[model samples]
Target: MSEEPLEQLDAVDFAVIAFHVDGEWDVDELTLDHLLDAPTLVAAMRRLPGEDSVALVAVDEDWFLVARVVEGRVRMLLSDATAAEDWDLAASVLDLLGLPEPEDDDDQVPAGDLGLLADLGMGAEDLGALIADLDLYPEEILSEVAEEIGFGDDFDDVVGLAPADHA
Candidate 1:
């Protein structure tokens, strides 16, 4: 949304998305490029807080399984992180803002992962398999998933991961 709709959004609407189910975080673990993608996601993920957190399983370097808990039901927020270039993220935002959906784009979400997969709570292996099916890699998926869920400042070691700026 062009403006923050904190009032319009309920705590349930505020999904605490995690990069992994194992439970970890990184300070400044997010980037601006990723922030641009959240609006659309926020729109589709309207249910809000269940386990108080969700996860993003990276199927590849670019794809992710953004799973969240809502009223005991799970919701998936899958996406091709690369599609932000063409306005998929922004469109999702507009949709959430109650704005009109943009004409046509390459950012359409597929059938299966569009909503929660099952009613029964899954075990670690099941969750892990879901992540594996989504193609999650610990380090890489962790980073990508972190960005997708808005965990920009949870990690303090971010600068250490990048080169120091030279004068």
Candidate 2:
């Protein structure tokens, strides 16, 4: 048994939040058992207080995952499918998507629901391009996504990444 929790975002000031429509989002922190399979993820999302919720799971500093629940349909997006080989959350997400485990070290395949944020601001092609850009960190990409989706500053505050509040 590993001492580290299965879902802790390893990067500094970066977190996975369950974004809600009503502005009441929460960090998506789950137990290892809860992340082992999809059913538990569905259960966890169902238990959330939001009418619409999405699991914005961070995959280290390099990538992230966004899983949304709407009308009982779970749509997911892995920021960098390559992270699947390294992160437990990404691998579990591939399981949920019914995709085979990623094996190729050179295969930087970005998989799952690419249109998860189509209605918000970014479409599949747009997100795919962003994920392919190796220069940006997951937090940088997510910050842009948050801004596009209308929660830029709030999200920064949630993750304590807000510019230092010098008084």
Candidate 3:
């Protein structure tokens, strides 16, 4: 695959901001100027009003990113580590995690904290399994993730997706 720099937020398929507060989960679309910039995405999540805030981003239908900010600390996960070879967002995510950029020979695997959402409900094993399923698309993987984390309906509503779409 050829490297294609993501120049703007418009290149992203969807960006959703989800938060848990007052024993309820809230979801909204994240509209930012730099959605693919890891630092910018994290900062935006931090500015949201919630005890726990997360940003779910799908880029070009090629990969998905999950960024969760809690008390100013950020944890991130990229669905396909090898996407760094072609995507600036994935490359930035590798930088944020202090990981080396994937080489061409590297396997297309997930990078960063698979356990990022463990406290919320999904464990590392489950997340790894989901990402391992190459038959699923980025959006489908993220949709399952949202469902596992108790924000399925909210996520679908905000992203204008229906469960049947994944079917």
Candidate 4:
């Protein structure tokens, strides 16, 4: 069957969200209620300062995934790093959301500047789709990254990975 058109996707059901994220940064396994605890996720999506929102997808209570969306795609979002805890709540959320695992072999691969971004993709279209699939709010993190880079411009082209600083 052809993929469902984005427009046709009704508002995501949030009754019992199975939010998920994928990547090394994930902190621990979590439930929908738990992910909701992170107010930043919601605030970023709404583009409101200090405002928070919750995932709208519904899921089985027994298990589900939760995560953050970066650059428009679902990535296993992390709260922070914990050395001893094997149960990563963020990773568990990514799994529930059906997000793919980030390639763990980044260290083995050679990288130049923006190597991490390159892993996301060399083209804007590919990256944009990936970002949209992400569970984490793209605007907030990207804005933060841009500001840190000293660009001080807004990255309007997540599709183009445009260097931005207007955030």
- Per-residue CA lDDT of candidate 3, range 47-97, in tens? 778769988999888789999998778899998888887777788899999
Error of 4 at 43 (Å): 15
Runs in model 2 deviating more than 4 A are 1-13, 19-39, 163-167
Ordering by lDDT: 3, 2, 1, 4
lDDT (10s digit) by residue, model 1, range 1-167: 54343322211112223333334532222222333444444433343322434443332234443555454444444444233233444334344434444344554433224324233334334434434555543334344334434453342134222321211
Clashes of each: 11, 0, 0, 47
Model 3 poorest 10 in a row by lDDT: 1-10
> Which scores better on TM-score, 2 or 4?
2
TM-score of candidate 4 against the unseen true structure: 0.22
What digit string (tens of lDDT, one per residue) describes model 4 on residues 106-167? 22211112222333322334333333443534433343333333221422332133554332
Best by TM-score: 3
Task: Rate residue 117 of model 3 by lDDT.
Answer: 94
Check candidate 3 and list the clashing pairs: none
Taking the tens digit of each residue's C-alpha lDDT, what string does model 2 give over 1-167?
36443334333234444547566545444544545445666677777776666655454466677777865778888766777666666777787899886677677777788888888777888778778889977777776666666566666666556643321
What is the lDDT, from 0 to 100, of the residue 92 in candidate 1?
A: 49
Alpha-carbon RMSD, candidate 3: 3.4
Q: Cα lDDT of model 4 overall? A: 0.30
Name the 10 consecutive residues with the lowest summed lDDT in model 4. 107-116
Stretches of candidate 1 exceeding 4 Å from the true structure: 1-50, 80-150, 155-167
